[model samples]
Target: MGGLRRAALVLVLPAALLLSGCVATPQEGITNSSSPSELIPAPASGAPTTSAPLETAQTSNKAPVYWIGRSNDNAFLYREFRDVPDQDNPVTRALRVMMSQTPLDPDFFTPWQNPKKLATSISGENVITVDVSADAFNSNVDAAMAERAIQQLVYTATAAAASAGLIDSGQQVQVVILVDGHTDYVAFNHVRLGAPTSRSAGLVAPVWIIDPQEGDSVGDGSVKISGRSTAQGGKLHWEILKVDADNAKTAYLNGTTTASTNAVQPGLFTLSANLGPGRYEVRVSQVDASDSAKELFQDTRGFTVK
Candidate 1:
């Protein structure tokens, strides 16, 4: 995640219409380009390995939005969203970081085929529309999962927006899904929409990679926890909490324990502060600077170190 990652081709799906933010336009059916001259980022951004930082802005007293698709990104949301003057929303920042992380690869794409990446933007409305590139469809994601992936993005952004506490209660934080500037189920081959073509949850392999799931058992050992939380025993990071009473009281736990690293997975975490005979509490919270505690998605299992 430190270095730049490689780029991929687009994944076009004729069967699955608008993935999420992509709305169906009257003319093209789906698109992020509101104008003909809009310059959509080549999804490559060159090749980003880590998560991309999202642009945050102060709340605006504007009307609610119904769609956040290609047209929306190019027309309304591009420059409108900004960071709060001096405030720092860690949650929002974390969302931005998660975005730049390794982008999803294309599905069912051929070696010779060139796929396009989908880029989205949000402005006037809370919606972030995406122009499903041919590359995305070609990525070979599951017909059913494609829509889910798109929807998850919408949910993530909305969660961030809600945390920012911007906009009004009248205007709901919503994210519309779109595909290739249109909102119709089609394949990379440009076939008409039909029955659910998605074989299962997705066309691409759903990965739950934990960079360092297991670490050294000895306290002197280099304990580095990682791997996909979605995987079995994936949430091994929070199993043990070291507590050293002699150490800083403000610290969360004892010994040298790694903090929870939310690497684009879903889950929660709790701490164990039961200082025993020789054990002492060091750090109190899971948020630490070592693992860059921004936003970690992990399964939460409460435990107290006996």
Candidate 2:
């Protein structure tokens, strides 16, 4: 993103939310409040257009929603494909669920409170406009977490738009958040809103388990596990741990495998193991460069085999 400069709201809707009367100023030394709307600058010259209906845009019944989760003792975004209501606008549907529903994985959660009203629309410039009620910004957080929370919306909105084919994948996608159609509101008492936000680099988990989502069940015998990593498809260490009735874990399997560097999604890896009926955990990690024996950016999933 380029240096901070004021951006004019080019598109205007007939009915918009009332502007917030409260005013907030960013505290000095807080870099998170800086604006980066240029990352998804408005197109040179194009009238903003709304997204097509679900019948024309949606590729599947599922919408991808990103949630905030802890990994390696730090917060990062994790995604899950959730079923969407038929005929509903995919982008707004996903955003509503993201703010209101509990994540399938216990480790993932959203700081947002469900707004009274929510809506989304895409522009010819590839910017997604998310007009959510002011109630959604009720959660209190620090500057760093607040920044991440806003990015959480950025990631979810863009993802939803992409999954529904509302925007072109080849072009950069950004999200412009408006509370009830008004801008310049402070979010969570930290980050300011109304800026065209893009996904902040390095805010996603380096490694995340995509299958057997936390607390899943599978059939006995051969079980397949897979995940995505950003380690440049380098060697990854994997292990399976069997949990006994006493809830103690016993090492079941361990090995080293390389993620597919050429995968369309990048760093995609898969492995399978044979096991009798039991509860088990699959963990994957890369060796810490400074300490080969220590694991770095580890991600794990628990599942039961019937």
Candidate 3:
């Protein structure tokens, strides 16, 4: 919630409305299952056809699917990934995963209707166009909720497209929303929906924990920490904290890493930390390279080791 405070102030619903437990339409394809393995079948074509290798698609084509979650006493959108099938339209499949209402983590949720409800496509120059159903805007929510809902779609679509290589990382992908195939439409009767929206970390969780996800238990001596960031020069700082009943304390494992050598695209970093059996919190932060004190973004997740 570091860099998101101002945006939240502008977009957050009234405290009473926020506390009223306004749940958005459940994601479309999610089920009460353990892994994405249960969500959908592999592509029918059954062959690797993209520029990316088939073996990589079969095993490593994991794409991020963004959803809403809570941390640091605030509600912000976060990301998780699913193994995308190796097919002609991997980007579309990834978008389907994002549009699906099911969250990999029980703690996450989304306010947007399923992407399947809208006809989604990637056009020239990495522009994603979503033709939304008129019925998709029937939510009785406030302006803040409506705004977040649109952002939910924008972030998810662009993220999915980037993961599938349809769009470049660190580059802004434009998302155009159409209602009943018309660009001029109102969303949720509150927010206008005619312009192209771009992905911004200020609108979504800028930091994410890519491994040892919430409620996970690791037997290995060390936990691998990794995630995507939009910070300057792709530089990131991290800290490991141990949580006890009375207080949460920082552990000795703390350091910094670069997500990328240049900051043109989303930067990724991985670190390994050793810990004994305990409950711990891992925090990732984006700081100004010139002034470390000027923290731009932060995110944290809890996990257990045994």
**Residue-by-residue lDDT tens digits, candidate 2, 209-242:** 7888878889998899988666654667899999
- Measured by lDDT, the strongest candidate is 2
Candidate 3's displacement at residue 118, Å, is: 3.2
Instruction: Compute each candidate's TM-score over C-alphas.
Output: 0.31, 0.79, 0.59
- Higher-TM-score candidate among 2 and 3? 2
**Model 1: per-residue Cα lDDT at residue 282:** 21
Error of 2 at 292 (Å): 1.1
Point out the higher-scoring one by TM-score: 1 or 3. 3
lDDT (CA) per prediction: 0.29, 0.70, 0.57
lDDT of 1 at 27: 40
Writing each residue's lDDT as its tens digit, candidate 3 over 1-306 gives 222212212211222232245333334332111111111111112221111101112224676666777544445567676666644254445556655557767767765555335556665455566666776665577555566567666776676555444554545566767676664466776556545666533445545666767767888586787776543245678999998877667675888876643323345568999888888888887656567665444677788888
The clash count of every prediction, one per candidate, is: 95, 0, 5
Cand. 1 Cα-lDDT: 0.29
Query: Alpha carbon lDDT of residue 256, candidate 2?
Result: 78
lDDT (C-alpha) at residue 276 in model 1: 38
**Displacement of the residue 256 alpha carbon in candidate 1, Å:** 23
In model 1, where do residues sit more than 4 Å from their true spots? 1-100, 103-119, 123-125, 163-171, 185-238, 241-270, 274-306
lDDT, residue 38, candidate 2 = 15
